[model samples]
Target: MTQQDVVSTGSTTEGRAPKGKALAATERIQAPVGGPGRGPMGGGMVGQKAMTFGPSARRLVAQMRPDRGKAVAVVVLGVISVALMSVGPRILGQATDLVFSGLFSRTIPAGVTQEQAVEGLRRQGDGNLADMLASMDHVVPGQGVDFDAVRNVLLVVLAIYAGAALLGWLQGFVLNTVVQNTVYRMREEVEAKINRLPLGYFDRSPRGELLSRVTNDIDNVSQTLQQTMSQLMTSLMTVVAVLAMMIWISPLLALIALVSVPISLLVTRAIMKRSQGMFVAQWRRTGRLNAHIEETFSGHSLVKVFGRQHEVEETFAEENDELYRVSFGAQFVSGLIMPSMMFVGNLNYVVIAVVGGLRVASGSLSLGEVQAFIQYTRQFTQPLTTVASMMNLLQSGVASAERVFELLDAEEEPVDAPATSAPAVRRGEVAFEDVAFRYDEDQPLIDDLSLVARPGQTVAIVGPTGAGKTTLVNLVMRFYDVDAGRITLDGVDITAMPRSALRGQIGMVLQDTWLFEGTIRDNIAYGRPDATEEQVLEAARATFVDRFVHSLPDGYDTVIDEEGSNLSAGERQLVTIARAFLTDPALLILDEATSSVDTRTELLLQHAMAALRTDRTSFVIAHRLSTIRDADLILVMEHGAIVEQGTHDQLLHAEGTYARLYNAQFAQAVA
Candidate 1:
């Protein structure tokens, strides 16, 4: 095929395009079974990809069991900080009262006896306590009171506040440590799950969506929780403590102080009620933006080839605008909470002063008492405002909590087998016994499928679009359980065995080969890390990967970029094939084994597959018939059922569906 004949990704050459043709035309197309790009359907299931947050986040934490101590320490620090803040105002008030008594001189008022003056001092102390406390706060000057003593008391108050502040800062530090730990642990878990999850999982979820959940969404929650533990919780404690003080000092004034609280709280609640939904939306848009970016970059080459850069940019702009709109709404509403609280607080202060002043002037209250009342009122309200502001953090934390919980609670693949025993083994053979599967329960893609690959023989599975060829391989690996039937290896059910054990002895190579960011030597030794260097090179040479590796800039030491994008598709395939060859498994499954490469690369892969399949149980799923002509058996699948089965020559002689497909493809190659 020349450049002119390079068709767009989903355009049909001769047959009808599968469903999702509309979405495919919009941007880069993903696997058919996976939903949109490679979605929940990519595994050819009706189930959406497991992209929820809660179960996933919990699992992330579970992965870092060692960090559990740090998480607990952080919470402890947070509680202590709250406790200190709650008691701070009262401690300062008590110290101020002591200084007031010491500074006024308890002797008689100029010639009165010491005993009478002591009695008078006791009387005046009540009258002076509020002013004394205010003076200690540096909010007023002491009259007939010792300035030195007041200074000493003020110093003590400062010490108390300083301790509270220190605890507050420490709480912040510990909370951040926990946040980072959670994120680190969660990220590790996501990576591990991604590695272990079946290929069908990737097929269903778009790479961008998963990336968003793992990276951005988790960050939002972590940041929110960090703030909640430090600032929000502390502020809430302070408000409660101050209110308790006011109510104790004088219930009347305390009642007046609280008049504005309900109004303020109402406004705060309304704002948050509106803001929380916006926040969730904003985060979702953030995920979509990430998904957009991933999609654009992943298919940059295709976009350039098709000259659709403008379309790409326009689509990106739309997603960006939506994100901006939602973000602005969320932040704007959350930001309003503080200023509104302050306004309501000031109003409450005015009412407290008016009511308290009348009582004081009427001699029902002492100056010190009134002053203390005012200070306590402000203290209570200040925390109320603070806690209100912190509500944003709380809502955010909860949202993240919800997301994290979703991931942590996700349906994990079963680990135990059913009570029933598997089929008795007659030979080291594998068979798909009436298997049917869908990623989701709603859609069934493969129905009543059955095939057999006898031990020491190679089998080929072939089909057109959505023919369930790859899904068959997934079942054999138990990457996914069949919805209807059971698959057996050596006549023993695959599902009955441990997945690790079942998959441990199986090797596979896919069309879009993936190589992690590592040295070429390491990539080949991935599954079998214990393999020797000699074994590594031998496998590489056997698969023809050594021919190219030696020619690279740094030979085997050269590092591959993400997904081996730096290498050509053929080179990537060669590396993956070599890795598979190194494993030397009992059963080998290759899906679209050589679909992406040129004729030369195809020939190399064909030679490599031939060597790899010798004396081993093998199954090859392919659209390219030429690569599998030598297979001992060929099974043709359609809509989840085995429609035809035979050898290459036998299928040709039978004049059935396989023969028609073979003839058509062969004629096309000749043409």
Candidate 2:
């Protein structure tokens, strides 16, 4: 199922075109279903297709097993409510017939006994009718009327309506609670699933798209449960009750009402067949438009700096126009359902009125029964109209549910097996033995790689872009396991150890620093959540973060905006370094950790790092040749293979790839 199948019902509202502010508000509201520019009913961008309804719907229902008793009670209440409500029109019709019968009957003198009147009719050879007439003694012709009987009928009808209303309210109340709790559980599960997913899964998926699933898709399911589920139950019950009442009143009129059903069905089927494709297009365009907006706005500054604002606007307009066109088509087509059904219903009404009038004249049917059947006919068609309108909501909801379930069912990171022994104490010694790996099997990235870092050794890796620098780091961190050979920590195979335990002993600081929206102290202590204020301050001082923190108005307690947007790039980098230092792991991985710092700060950070690396294994990846000049060992990599390995001075003297890179940087510095 495509998004086109999930058109919004709000678009069907008829009115003059919205202007100015109203137009903008409408666009925002409709952004998830339809928008400004769209294709014909059958046109829009195709998205991740929706799954078959059966499996997903069944799973969703099963998820509600915990609320099964409440759901059953709600359904039962709905049925009783509808049944009581359905009997109202028939009872009213009976009252109407009684009033008519008394109005036309022979005038009985005032104070005449009901038995006397019955005896007179009995003598006329209508003994059965006389007996029935005797019971309605107060309903005398001309001289008086049966006000008491009318009052009693009205009372009964009022009681049924009140009971139905009470039950209806109760059902809604219970259903609301069930739906809210069910959605809450689903959201919790999705959040947990996100934590269990592999990093590679995120690498291959767009962050915005994943966010759409978590927020938009799940919200759609919640809305459907809250709104559509109750309406669906009420509509179905109403249709059934209305039909039964119609038949009970008079089979002939019921048959006449039945004719409208097939006609209504045919009209609905034809319109739906044409509209479904357009609805799909509408939803698909909405998603695409939303994603484009999200992407563009997130990088708004970049677009402006690059002078590409016009291009972005043009792209947006194109998607927006497509959305409008498809939405218009889908809404227009679906709007046909109510009028057509009403037309069929009206025609059936005409037939029933004419036939029932002739029957009443022939004394075959009462005026009251015909009136009651007409009301039933109207009630029956109302549910059909409701169902028709609700189809879009139901389909959209299912589509959203399917997307959410797809994410929940996605492949997760492999779980570790039971460890044969407890993790060994580390001595800062790491080794990679003949490791081979590739992101894609057809293109090998690392081939027969072997390396070792002895205790307290510094291993600096220098390489050009696409030289597997990051991939190697990822392997060491076990973010991705090697396809062949083994990596060990202190001579023990790393794979045999649990990932959490292994990662706990390693610290990394990347070039792209990430900080959450919190105070500077909180960000510094992220790696060690339980760190004391003194420890946080020490780590901050070691990374030179304290220098800037003390200058801010609130010092360490200053609140940071999302992504640390409130701070400078260098400041963000320092916060991350502080986070790494607080952990004080046995092994450290620094990937251009000082790239964002100026010369003065870099010197201070380098001094701190040198002291921190004493008696600890450290791997530094950098493009700046001057940064690792004093390393104990330097590995020059080319095309995923190490071309040279030695101390910085030794590699510079040998004049291989490392020497050339160093000479070039040195030449540029002098120039």
Candidate 3:
């Protein structure tokens, strides 16, 4: 066929124009199956429900097991700090007692002894003052406020507080290190897990949702740990230390303060139970919203071309509103914890004050002790309030943790056979033996399929969409393993070899051209990172990428944007072709490799591909029959079964599936 015979209109061999209504449907971003509004799950069931709080919280803590030593240090330093701080209130009480005694004792006439002043007060019928003096310790009669002793006691109190502050800072520093290290390890695990997962996982999951798990969720976990871990530990410790001080000062008042513990706990537990599910919902909706945005932006041009901006905006608003609803519910429910705990704490405070004041007046406890007990009450109540308030952070963090953990727990690709290696000699022969496979068990696809492509043979596969065309290539690449039978490379089972080793021998250029953000040279050399400049240039020239590179301002050094929008479709396709060519693989797979280029560029790419196929087994899937007319063998597939197989002329003569397809394209071309 002449070039003119193959170049009539922008249409595929499937008898459809490239920019027809079918393209519009294919271009619009469809939501994933389990995406927003479908159910409680997000990212293909990454979050099935709000995981049980206990287990999720425990698992999060388990991640920090490796940092146990640092955690222990944090605990120890916290205890020491709380201990030093606890002593400050008692010392302050001592200073207060000293000043009070000296002032009252000085009110007694000068040179009067302490017993005489007290006896005189009692004789004057001032029994209340006498009782207060009796309750006070270390009071010297006729001594004015001893500024020297008070100064000494205040100095001691300041030093204790200063030391406690220093230790607290150190504890926080150590705790920060632990939290950061734990989060770092978790991020590394998530990164590694992504590589271990099978292709099917990604096929079902939305990209934006998965990204939220890897990025936003993990970040939330880190922030939660940073905010809560230290505070929780210190708060609990303060409660204990303060409780002990309270009991030492007055058991009755201590019992009154203890009344709030159960009430605070009950309030926190109830609020947490209600908000846990909301937090999970909040993050799940967040992932869904993110997926929607990512898909819309990725297909922004398609959306605009089809004038679907309003539709995209509507979908985004719906998901955004859903996210806002869940977020508000989670926050509002968790926010109730603080006020409820505070109310209980304040009630306990009133009771403690009433009981302690009466006890002080009854001469059962010193004024100084009452002062210390009140301070202890505040310390105790404050920590309880803190722990309760942090329920918000705790719930949010654990919810995010569950999402990330779900990803970590996803099914991974089967491990390769132990001690396996690729076949020797790299003969480039591939064979499928009655392979049976299906994405869904109930929906059979590619059943009992068998075929072989000998070394150096160019096998072209033509099939309609959903005809298992891509599945065949995927099986060959071991992206998904066959459910039955086996595929072999050079007479050895491909599964017996490691995926990396098997893939290293095969080079593929798909229908979509992917170019990362890098220079033209870098994109071309992506398949062979160690390729020398000379080798890269040779590949570029062979694939005709040099044709356009020379015209650019930076030649091969011109950078491609993230979307590769800087280059035209044809240019990007040529760069990808060059990328595959640079690999010099033992086998090649081209899936509509020339679909994006114009007739002229497609013809040039055909020649470049012909050269690239030399001495290498090649599997070419194309919708354009003209591009594969010279293929050594052409297999016509429909519904996962090959209906015809022969050279172009033989298949045309047979007047079957291939003939009808070829005739239709010919008719269109002639018209």
Candidate 4:
């Protein structure tokens, strides 16, 4: 079930956003389709099953060329060391054979040269340690372990152990760094990409879902790499080493052990084919449930006002129910992988034991050889099962990789056309010429339109609800570039100006205010990080926000909770205004600046707007038109077109659309 974490998010946090809007970095990406090795960035980002110690295990191994020349040499030496370890077991086997043959027969095998024959004889005689080991010591317990052979084997084994240890350590060190750094880089890049996306992109996407992709999905990737990589690699190596040992010991026994391998793999493949999609569905459902709860809680005031608790709870329950079904199935299927492989592993072990026992009874193999063969069989079953489980993990990584790819594959905003050179505001003039735009083509919010606001003047736009006033403001900001005609700044077409450069000169106080987790001074100084203390206080003072802020024990350093929930609505707006004031842009947009405030706060904010607009070009969207009587230009917008434009006195005399709106609004207030 999608449990509600209704932890106290009191209205004391009203002045700010909830915890964090910066997307989570360590996200758990579910696998989608077509395997996990690719992202939209390209076809091969990383391997999903990189954990398996097989050939693919090397993919997880950092191919990082070490910075130090000595480290490189050491690393290479370590690999050679692990390869040499196999010789110790072979030597022991040969010594066993030599001892047995000496006790039973005197003659050496045909393969022995004259010098080798002498070494074998010494080993049989058990003379001095050196003489006995040196003889067949090179062969079996040959001549025995004298100082020389003992030292050599010890050195060789030490080197092999060192090499394996080095490989193990370096693999861990580099992989951790790479995964962590990659996540950090991805978070930064994703943030930048999200900023460039059109506002319309946010219309359909849930805030929580996007957050989870950046946070939970990437975390899943990191965790998988950390815990699984080593086990997977070791298991794979064991499988390969044991299989080779099995063949060398007895090809027939090796052949008998391998009969179930294909069956286990086929079953794994079939289960994966079914489970991959279910895993992805489970994650998707979780995102939906999270989004629903977030929206319901974030906007709880509206929900309760409308008595939507039952409706929202019912919706959440249904989504949670679906998620439960999907999760149970996905997890149930995931749980099957290891167990199924173990079952096959057991069968392989039983067969090998039965067949090898019969072969030994026939006198085809030595006691020691049979002992080693049975040891190899145990190695086969365990590592084979390990390899099988690795296969499952690898497949999961592939699935997760696919999901990560899907997220990375999400369409980023297209590059702006090459019209921008360097956008500068000399006179700070803006013009919209026959602009048309839409989030969806079939439902254009802004139709063919034209307007202009000269430098050093206030342009107030008034309209009934759903009349596209805010859409017009969005056009001026080039949030969604015009589908037709063009917009310009100071006679230069804005299409030729970099969006960042264009936006750098504009200050805004939006209806929806959000503040990061920081002190009040930091929040006000957000738009100007390097702003001096005096400057921040000045901005606050202009908005009259400092009056109440100073009342707190910490004064300007008072910390605010997310979304400024610790403050009143008016306080949030003033802080936002203070942030905009610090920008000191040539152009200003006050969108519903006073909509959520009480009368006293509205008057205070109105004074702040006037202060901030002294010598700048400005646009204000007025809900209460009475506040705009002093506007230099009054534009009455209807369906994205300006139907009336003039001063308050001129429009009143004209008795047009502006006059009708004025009468209706004034009459409503009187009633």
| Candidate lDDT (C-alpha), each | 0.67, 0.74, 0.82, 0.64
Candidate 4, superposed: residue stretches over 4 Å from native: 1-170, 390-396, 416-425
Q: TM-score per candidate, in order?
A: 0.80, 0.85, 0.93, 0.78
- Candidate 4 C-alpha lDDT tens digits along 1-671: 00011101111111111111122233223322343211111111111221122332233233223323443543444334334433335444544554544443234454555455555556676434223223232343123224454556456656655666666666557555655665566566566666654544443356566665666665665666656655555556666666787788889988888887888779877777677667666656766666666667667877788787788778778989998998788777866877998888778778877876666545466545766676666666676566556554555454444445445545544565675555453677888888877644566566778888999889998887757777676666665567798888888787677666677777777776777789998888877778898998889998888889978879888899877878899888888888888878888887777888899888888898899888999998887878899999999887667888989899999999888888988896798
Task: Supply the global lDDT for candidate 3.
Answer: 0.82
Q: Write the per-residue lDDT of candidate 3 for residues 214-242, one digit (tens) a residue.
A: 99999999999999999999999999999
Per residue, candidate 2 scores C-alpha lDDT tens digits across 201-290 of 544343455677788878988998888888889989999999999888778878988988889889988887677666656655666677
Shift in Å, residue 598, candidate 2: 2.1
Full-model lDDT, candidate 4: 0.64
Q: What is the lDDT of residue 77 in candidate 1?
A: 66
Give the TM-score comparing model 2 with the true structure, all chains together: 0.85
Best by lDDT: 3
Ranking by TM-score: 3, 2, 1, 4
lDDT per residue as tens, model 1, 304-341: 88887887788779989998998888878888999999
Residue-level error in angstroms, candidate 2, position 601 = 2.5
Report the error of model 3 at residue 115, Å. 3.2
Question: Among these predicted structures, which one has the highest TM-score?
Answer: 3
